[model samples]
Target chain A: MKRLKKVGLIAVVCLSLVACQGGVPKEALELSPESLQQRQTQTRRFDTNNEAKLLTSGAQVLQDLGFTVEDSETKLGMIAASKDRDATETGQVVGAILLAILTKQAQAIDDKQKISVSLITRPISAKETLVRVTFQRVVWNTRGQVSKTEPLDDPKLYQDFFAKLSESVFLTANEI
Target chain B: MTNTVKKTACAALVVLLLAGCQTDSRDQVLATSESQVALRSIQSRVFDTTDKAKTQRTIIATLQDLGFVIDKADATLGTVSATKLNGYAMRMTVSVRDHGTKQTLVRASAQYNQTAIEDPLPYQQFFTALEKAMFLTAHDAD
Candidate 1:
């Protein structure tokens, strides 16, 4: 009876300490509204009336960028693609340590990361179409649990995508 | 006495560790009515062409060109939805209907991470870009 009472008391104290640790820190989970607004404003638009041609050109551009085209629908005017990135040495080591501490399952030196891209097309008129592209980076632990989901908001990245897309569109237009 | 204390400590640790694993769901804030009214005011555009299919196709193409992944498209209903994520997720849905035999109306709404984006600039920019694309598409048809 005494042992049970002592255990209960210890459990209560430890649980209280854990509770004080709290949930995932807000900073770690959410991006600031200012940054989100900046990102939204920074996203540029493209004008094209030929939905079919644009869809084809967009797929070609993504493929040229080394992204595997996962899905494409001309009628829907949407494409999904993903690229694989090899984790850096430091990342792997730190991931391993974190995994061992968190889930106790660590047995790999090579961790692979993935970046996904999604594109949507909207039409404003018979002669106009608007395109929006989004990029995301996902990191998974050896246990297959998602560790991080970061949005890629580099202006240069968007510029590069648009540049390639323009080239593809030109080629498609000229049939060259 | 020592054995009893050790057993008690182990039991306590187990219970505490299990309790620590509990997690809370993230909270989301609702948009104000003023923002909703403002968003509704600018979410629509009128196209010159009466061809609903062509207008719908152009909208889909424009979304694709902008790098949004199409989630759903319905021709009979004249509705399309596409989603994109850059840290935050945005879903844009467009609905097309005939205003007259020679004119079509397009309505679009954007949601950022499940919350309505009440800003008019993004919607205006999108419509402006769409207008340009429509011109290009018309040129191509010729």
Candidate 2:
């Protein structure tokens, strides 16, 4: 009887181990730095002139919206500023610009939003030569109206915003 | 026959199995699979059409409708080109490569903007849309 119980326990443990491993897929594994670098070497560069033109077009689309251009600059990348109220309202303007240019969905602007964005280089230890763009967008709502701002620390959101603004400004500058 | 001994043996077995499964190129295999699937989906749907001019029109129109300003739309070297709207300096290029057979490779790439140095979200979306468009076009039924 004791041997039977021991065998039963062993079988149970083995079944549990098999279950755990079966759930993990071989394709989901992460890669090492060396291999990642190897892949990066094959990365191709897209056309810069065409990229610049796209940014310019995006800037024009923003102007067509209701927001007035408070400030606009296009150098290497691009930055355009338009204000409606305080920081929050300005965020909505940015959000509205993003929505208009991105999804074509009209989103209301609020007055309590705060956002900040920054771009920097990788800290040396890792793989290929890559640039990092960071953004922070905060939104507040009261009485059915909402406001937003940029410069948030969210990498994903920041990346999207950076791409849109960059392409728009780049293309716009080239057009002129 | 103690519980500790059984558990230890099981743990050791698990470790050995895991160790055996490890490979230097495992990551590469997975990455290649994901990229291949993405590439295949894009190639299959975007360039599967017979009307080259109509394909170009659809691509430009869809991009423009998505708030991307058309910088230049040209059909050359079996490719279609367009730029983004207003302030984001992103561009999309669609290329069709014919290698003798009826198979075509449609590659759509959007810019990876570094200027603003603040955000890259817009450019990523632009790229995603380009890829998605290509995939949709290639996979469309005849």
lDDT of 2 by residue, A1-176 (tens): 78557766766665565442222111111222442332232112222434334335445544543334332222222223332434445665776788878887666555454332222211122322222222233455543443333223333443354455445444211110
- For residues A1-176, could you state the per-residue lDDT of candidate 1 as single tens digits? 88678777777777776653223222321223453453353344455577677778788888888999876656656677889987547876877789888987755554567888766555556766655667777666655655665666677787677777777787322110
Lowest-sum lDDT 10-residue window in model 1 chain A = A21-30
How accurate locally, in lDDT, is each candidate? 0.64, 0.40
Q: How does residue B62 of candidate 2 score in lDDT?
A: 43
Fnat of the models, one by one? Answer: 0.15, 0.00
B33-114 in candidate 1: lDDT tens per residue? 3455555557877777877777777776566445455566777788877765444556789998877676778888877654
Angstrom error of the Cα, residue B115, model 2: value is 30
